[model samples]
Target: MAPKLDIETYPGNIINNEFVPTPNTRHSINPATGSPLFKVPVTRAEDLDAAVEAARKAFKSWSTTPFSERAKLLLEYTDAIEANRDELENLLTKEQGKPLSLSHTEMDFALSWLRAFATMKIEDEVLQEDEEKIIYSTHPPIGVCAGIVPWNWPILLGVGKLGPALITGNTFIMKPSPFTPYCDLKLGELAKGIFPPGVVQVLSGDDNLGPWITEHPGIDKVAFTGSIATGKLVAASCAKTLKRCVLELGGNDAAIVCGDVDIDKCLPKITTLSFLNSGQICMLTKRIYIHESIYDEFRNKMVEFTKNNIKTGAGTEEGVVVGPVQNKMQFDKVKDIYAQIEKQNWKTALAGQAEESRNGYFITPAIIDNPPEDSQVVAEEPFGPIVPLLKWTDEDDVIDRANALRTGLGASVWSKDLKRAERMARRLEAGSVWVNSHFDVDPRVPFGGHKESGIGMEWGIEGLKHYTNSRSLWVWKKIFE
Candidate 1:
């Protein structure tokens, strides 16, 4: 169960680096009980303008701060988070339920984000020189930026974007999803108390507000992580200003299980990744392509492992598996998607069931067997406790089939022979691939998608570049020609 929070005191956008509850607001409720989760202010255009102005004003000085100074402050922020890890974990569980273990790991992902991004070097490098002339390349902040984060991995996505953007000296306006607002607010609380007002403005608002932020002339850049539809709209809005963008969107990730792999060994890993955070993650594997030579045998082992091993409870617990769906809309999506899958003439697979006692929009982890490639379950991201499996006899045929989708975010290949797995991973046509692993990401590695998955990248050195604009300085030798 989520820890008790005073829902009445829910806050709003952190404008000008201060938390204020806007008169206009959106209410959040626990999916399990339909009880009040927390109320966050739904900001208006004026509110967005305030956030932008604050970020812009703050950016004037923030951008001037030396890289080492920013690095020092980022380290301080990291320490602040470490001081209240447990409290933040509670916030995560209350709003977005996953296993307690995974929640803790998410915090770890945040810590590493600060540590990794802060260590980046931004020094002027002289490319060519003459007696009194030099051509220099220097990276500087792009002023204020807007980061629209998704609900699935709130802290991870928010921090991943913020860490790099801020470490590079740009002030930020983070629009976190309404489903889990408290944690982001809590992050804002920490920042406002420590950093200069407007250095980091965290806001909460409805859907349309994102477009306003992107289109706002004050914002120099935008880094968004969400669905393809919304991402497209955001891209269009940013294009009006030609502001740089780093979009990381949807992923109907694929996992290829070869005949050579041991189903018993790979089953647990696949299930863990497929259902990580109840499959709400963008890069999570939603489609499983298995070799036909051992489909049935593999299914039996995988199904048994999934049925017996997965757990559903609050993330505060020590060994809980998947927790409640983030909110009712997600619960309905999971339900509707499963109903469609079951109604289809495709072969029936083992289905997940939400225990009657479980409340707050919880659903069983679904496993579809030998489903048709055309099935929506196959093509769409269920983004829930659901897994779809398809059998492929011809390797090239299946690879082509998986590559046919609009989303090519993350993918995996499980095989005893590492060479075969690597070959298939290369052929999979996605951003990042793992051998015998699913959705295992490190702060140091570049993570993004292929095709509609997104453009540009996040959470690596490449991510730092998102907050920057490169300039080349050329000086005349010997006082001009």
Candidate 2:
């Protein structure tokens, strides 16, 4: 059964395990119906100050806890989240409007991370002892850090940042996207009681509050996930104070269907990922380049698959493959792409339309046939369900064309011959490449971007180090008679 979308509203910032309403207030709407879901208090300058100060106060004690002890608490957190999985999933669907099942998957993925980063061998990895002078190294936590996350996969991404920050002993002040703050609040409500006061806090509001937090001198580091342009601003803001930044930004990921692959099976998967979260994802395959020998056949199959599979409607409805665009801005952006495509005389192989009598933010999936490689529609990243496909004559040409785009977060290669696919994957200029799958994230592996896609990497063993600073201690024994 689909879960009820009765969003529970919380007034303001959760600082030091207390909910105190601020001077400002805001409304959270359900994107599926464009109806007001909940009216909640917003963040203010005072709220931001309280959050930073709370984290600052907590850091004095949290930073000294044993890594093993911290690991135990993370495992407890995982258990608690798993026990209330259904409730958590409901909160995600209420404000965010993603399919409930997918929401659960996100939560399940988070549990694995809680344990992975928790049980990590930090003592072995960071602490080294030498008999000569009792030389050792310690991984100290960065002081009060702020984690600013985007709307897409809200809970999961927040957990991704949370797991590492806590395991490495950093107290945090988290701010979720205003578009979907319900789940973020739920996390705060639950965690405030479970963890120590001021150890982890949440602030929900508009973009203004976030900028204020980023520029706050009290914050030692800023970890964000959003657009490349906004990421640039975050990086710049942190630079002035010499504060650390971890930004996971935008990507115009490319998908290549080589000459030797089966067109019938792979085309469906390609169409599925192109509009994931309504193509709001940074790792989505926005650009598609096909081998010319099989280009015509692939395009036809892609059109058929897209038309049949990608259905858009209320996220809580049954049998819906994709949900409504998260809000009005998303809807307008998608419509703008449609209007632009029509004006350019570009061919739309499979076109989807918004339904009448529905007050929802929605759009059908689109499959655009051969467009000029240099055209903005093909070259620029259109973060909508619409995708433009291009054709190249040879394998090398396809590689070159795919790598031409500036953003390089993720790329995909589809082929039956493993060797060819592997070679092609290596040639694509991105942080991650998938041979058969489009977007699959593993906690044990490192995930990040290259070039304009963003900086540094997260996940894996090295990811834990991002929240910590290493200190080397050395002492020489004096030779005395």
Q: lDDT of each structure? A: 0.80, 0.80
Candidate 1: the clashing residue pairs are: 25-42, 31-360, 31-361, 32-359, 32-360
Could you give candidate 2's per-residue lDDT for residues 185-265 as a string of tens digits? 767766776678888899987878878977899999888898898999999888888888888889888899888888877
Q: Judge candidate 2 at residue 180 and give its lDDT.
A: 83
Please list the residue runs of candidate 1 whose C-alpha ends up more than 4 Å from where it truly belongs after superposition.
1-12, 129-133, 314-318, 354-359
Q: Tell how far residue 59 is off in model 2, in angstroms.
A: 0.9
- Tell me each candidate's RMSD, in Å, in order: 3.0, 3.0
Q: Per-residue lDDT of 10-85 in model 1, one digit per residue for the tens? A: 5667777666777877767655455776568888888888888888888889998888888988888888887778
- Residue 314 in model 1: shift from native, Å? 4.1
> Model 2 clash tally?
0
What TM-score against the true fold does each predicted structure earn? 0.94, 0.94
> Lowest-lDDT window of 10 residues in candidate 1?
1-10
